[model samples]
Target: MKVNKDLTATASANLILDELYTNTGSSSFNLEHDFFYGGAELEIWTMANQAGILLTEDTDYTLSDIDDTLTNQASRNVYKAVTIDNVTYQSDDIYFSYQACADFVDADDRYMVTREDGQYWDLNSSGGFDLVVSDDITFKDQYLASAIPLSESGTTGLEGF
Candidate 1:
């Protein structure tokens, strides 16, 4: 899929997820229980405008008398910024951030069950499982705004100045 990298970070993530589901039988796949446990990682990357360029093709043309054709098409060099996000990560921060969950109808004490040797066990059993829960999720209506400006240069081309 072709996309303008600088503006489609979130869209890229969604596309990755969609592709996974599609390839693995979308109708039978469960995102949380299947894909997450199946070891799927989401990663994102951002780059400055200096790293790329955008080319704009000109539409203006002149008529040629000899061949009876249009000629002298105009075009402009437009700098482009690219941002890439994928399932594979290039940084450590994104590599370690992941979460998984499961659903059980039993009581909290018996949420998790396991078997060891010849013994059946529950999470709350002696030396069974250690559960930790946190409620530190932050929700924001809008993102923090910055005053960065887009500028073009003769040597380095377009960038945030």
Candidate 2:
């Protein structure tokens, strides 16, 4: 199996849970995808222009979640942002960044599982590297499809790296 490692900081600013017309006054929202696991600090701008006023945890919003299990993670993806008094966001006006994972694949077509010590957080913390892969996984001995063509620099000059 191949894992697609993506540390992309996709700044999603699509919907506004609160507005003058709709007036949902929503207190929370979810990222575009689940299984976010963990990531960098969250980022939120009140204006489309990204004015100097950047929102933060506790002061402007609150974020929480415990990605301890596969089934428990999706619910943890919910992000709760406090309302800014009368400053209702009537347009595209919220953004954030975090580390995420779509962890079914691995880099070298090698198979991996989150079943280390029989826990989900093992993949992120603990001895994740020590996880067990069943014998079903077949190794691809050759990393390169063809022989490497050296510049002959190694023999020509020992100084060449």
Candidate 3:
């Protein structure tokens, strides 16, 4: 999936990484910290007043419900489809950044979608199997040093390690 850099709408730039890496660069030259700050925030809302409507009467619900809510809120415009292994999957949970919802309207295919940072996987599919999202989805976060230790040599650069 591509994270769009266009702040005009909600879709922000999405990048894929085969492995995770830690930033050991200087505080002013840290690429990871800059990368995380570049990420956009997504906001989701209901189209109809039935925003509280639950997909299922039972406590248990399928991913379909989430997919439906998104698509329905988006009205199928911004995020028309989600494909996995060339197979398109539909969901009610559609996501777009905060800016994307500015002019958003709710219609048949209109629904709200939110961007989340972390791993998301589709535990089940119509093919009678679960599809791991690890291979298909990419997550981004604001990179920052977990902790910045103080420097003894008066080198402030080593303090925020």
Candidate 4:
């Protein structure tokens, strides 16, 4: 009879190695935290509110849930986009930056994004939107380096001395 054993420890180590070297092809143990920063692609629906354009939960632009924040180490820097008459335009894209929130706790769930002209808008039930956000984000890892690598020289055999 054969018994199966879990390789949790080995798997954990491999997971760490893959993440560190997935982009650079080499692991860097010197990172203060195991937060590997990477770029992620995202698409959010938008709508024109009373003030200006804002993100909507669904393509209908009638949803109340507004996903205004990209929860990362830093604020999610987003590049905006819009669709009109079944045609997309990139030049008319909007840029929204993270600003102060009424409550930091609420900010964790969803925060406000201000326009480049320093204006914050409210969401309204208007046309549907197609907003694309591509930004770099860093995530934290639980593991830490416990040991350093040691060097060893090859052994030469001298028999019958």
Worst 10 residues of 4 by lDDT: 17-26
The predicted structure with the larger TM-score, 1 or 3, is: 3
lDDT of 1 by residue, 1-161 (tens): 12222112233332332121112211221232111211122221122221222111121111111111111111111111111222222221211111212211122323132222323222221222233221221212112211222334212111121
Q: RMSD to native for every prediction?
A: 26.3, 17.1, 19.8, 23.2
Q: Write the per-residue lDDT of candidate 3 for residues 1-161, one digit (tens) a residue.
A: 21323323333333222211122121122111111111132222122222433222112211111234333454432332212111111223322222222212212211121114443322122311133222222322113112222455432121111
Full ranking by lDDT = 2, 3, 4, 1
Q: Candidate 3's error at 147, in angstroms? A: 36
> TM-score, each model?
0.15, 0.33, 0.16, 0.17
Report the backbone clash tally of model 3.
Answer: 34
Pitting candidate 2 against candidate 4, the one with the higher TM-score is: 2
Between candidates 2 and 3, the one scoring higher on lDDT is 2
The sequence of per-residue lDDT tens digits that candidate 4 reaches over residues 17-59 is 1111112111112121111111222222222222235333223
lDDT of 2 by residue, 112-152 (tens): 22222433211222213333233222223233121232355
lDDT of 2: 0.35
Rank order (by TM-score, best first): 2, 4, 3, 1
Model 2 stretches astray by more than 4 angstroms = 1-24, 37-40, 48-50, 70-92, 103-161
How well does candidate 4 score on lDDT at residue 14? 18
Q: Model 3 off-target regions past 4 Å?
A: 1-9, 14-68, 78-122, 127-161
